[model samples]
Target: MTTTRTADPTAEPGAPSTTTQASLYQQLRAHLAVLRLYDAAEHLPAVLDAAIAEGLSMTAALERLLAVEVDATEARRLAGRLRFACLPTPATLAEFDYDAAPGVDRALIDELATCRYLESATNILLIGPPGTGKTHLAIGLVRSAAEAGYRTYFTTAADLAARCHRAAIEGRWATTMRFYAGPTLLAIDELGYLALPAEAAAAIFQVVSQRYLKTSIVLTSNRGVGAWGEILGDTTVAAAMLDRLLHRSVVLNLDGDSYRLRAHQARNETLRKTTTGTRKPLS
Candidate 1:
C-alpha cells in the first residue's frame, strides 16, 4: 500500500508538479541524463530534497546542484592527472615525518607546495645521504604538483638514462626527448645511487638541457654536486647538467639517521626486552 505525502508547501515556485515524489525524481534524472549531466543527475535527488526542506529559492537549488557536479568533475580530473603522473607511490607532504629529518626546512617545503615555481620552470633538488628521505620528499612534491593540475612524471635517474639510451638506439631520440620534456614537472629519483653507463651522463645532460627553463624538475640524489662527476663518469657532462639544473633551483639537503636502520634497531630492542622478560633467573 503506497502512502501519498503532500509536497513541501515552502518549496520554490516552478518546482516539480503534484505527481508522486519518486516519479518526479525519476523524470528529473532522465532529463538530466538527456542533457548529459551525469554527475549532476546522480546528485539531483539529494539537492532537490535539501532545497525543498530548507525552503531554498530556485536559483539556490540550481546552484547547489551544479556545485556538486563541479566538485565531482574536479575530483575525477585530479585522479586522471595523478594516474598519468606515473608516480612510484602516492606519497603526500602530510605523510612526511619532519621530526625524522630535522635538517629539512618545513617552511621551504610548504612554499614549494604552492606550485608558483612551475610558472617560471624552477627546479628542486633533494640532496642527502641514503635513507635520508630524499625520495620521499621528491615524491611528495611530485604528488603536490599533480594535484595542482600540472602534468607530471617520475623516474629514477638510472632508469631515465637507460630509457634515453634505448630510445637513441631505436632511432627515436627526438621522440624520447619530447616525451621527457612534455611533463610540466618531472621527478628523477635516486640520482647517483648506482654507477650509470659511460654514455648515461650525456643522455641525462641532454634531458636537463632540453627542459631547461621550459618545465620544472624535482630530483633526489644521495651524492653531492661535486661527486656527480665521478658518479656519472664524466666531469664535463655533469658540470653542464648541473649548470642548467642549478640555474633556477631550490636545493634541499636532508640529514638524519637512516629510517630503516632506526626501525631495525627498535625491533631488535623490542625483541631483547621480550626475551629478557620471559627468561627465568639462571641457576
Candidate 2:
C-alpha cells in the first residue's frame, strides 16, 4: 500500500515548516554577543554559507572564524602599544642606508631586528658622530620592539633629564623613574648632546640601576664611553651606570661622515648649477 502525507496548514509556500533553524541562529548570535565575539557574529552568516558550500566540517569552520578574531585583536593591541611608544617617526630596517654607513654592522642590525635581545633584557649602545643615523637606527629598533608586542618608549637624553628633574621638583621622581624603567625597551637618543646637571645625572643613573638586568635600553650617543663622565658631570656615577648597562649589552659603533651635511652639500651644488645655467653668458 502507498500513503501520501499533506503539508501543515501553518507552513508558508516556500519556507520551512519548523522554526528550529531561525531559533538556533538567534541563540548562536546571542551567545557570540555575550562572549564579546563581535567579529565572529558579524561575519557568521557569510562564513557559514561559504563553509557549507566548501563542505567544511563544523569544527574547521569555527576554527577559521576564531582565527580572524584573534588576528584582529592582536592588531588592535599592537596599535595601542605603538601609540603609547611615542616614537619620533615610524621607521624600519629596510629604510636604513646600509651602504652609506659601511662602518655599521648590517648583519648585527639585522639580527637586532629579530628582537631576541629583548627576551634576554640586553642593552644596545649605538655610538656614532652626529647625523650618522644613530637616532634613525635607534628609532627603527624601538618600532620593531613595539610591533613585536614589547612595551617601548623613546626620548632624547636631554629631554629625559629635564623631565626627571621636573619630576623631582614635583616630588614625583619615583613615579617618573618607574615609568622610564617599566618599558621593555627604553630608547634614549642624543645622550651626549647636552651636559646634564648632577641631580639630573643622578636621576638617570637611578633609572639605569633600577632597570639593570630586568629591562632593555637602546642608547644612541655621539660621545664615547670615556666622555660620558664629562657629559654627565660625574665620573663615579657614569662609571657605575656604565658598569650596569654594559654588563649585558651589545655595543654598535657607527663610524661615518655626517649624512645630513653631505645631503646639504649636494643640494647646494645642484642649486649652484641651476643658477649658472640660467645666467647670461659673458661676452
Model 2: residues >4 Å from true position, as ranges? 1-19, 269-283
Q: Candidate 2, 234: how far from true, in Å?
A: 0.9
RMSD of every prediction: 4.2, 5.2
Q: Which pairs clash (backbone N, Cα, C closer than 3 Å) in model 2?
A: none
Residues 62-181, candidate 2, lDDT per residue (tens digit)? 998888778888999999998888888877777999888998888999999999999899999999889899989999999999888899999988888899989989999889988998
Report the C-alpha lDDT of model 1 over 1-283, residue by residue, as the tens digit: 9988687878654456566855776788899899888999877767877887999999999999999888988899999988888888777898888999998888988999899999999999999989888888888888898888888999999899999999989999999999999999999999888889988898888889989999999999998899999999989888899999999999988898998898899999999999999999989
Any idea what lDDT model 2 has? Answer: 0.88
User: How many residue pairs clash per model?
Assistant: 0, 0
TM-score of 1: 0.89
Question: In terms of TM-score, how similar is model 2 to the real structure?
Answer: 0.86
Which 10 consecutive positions of candidate 2 have the poorest summed lDDT?
Answer: 10-19
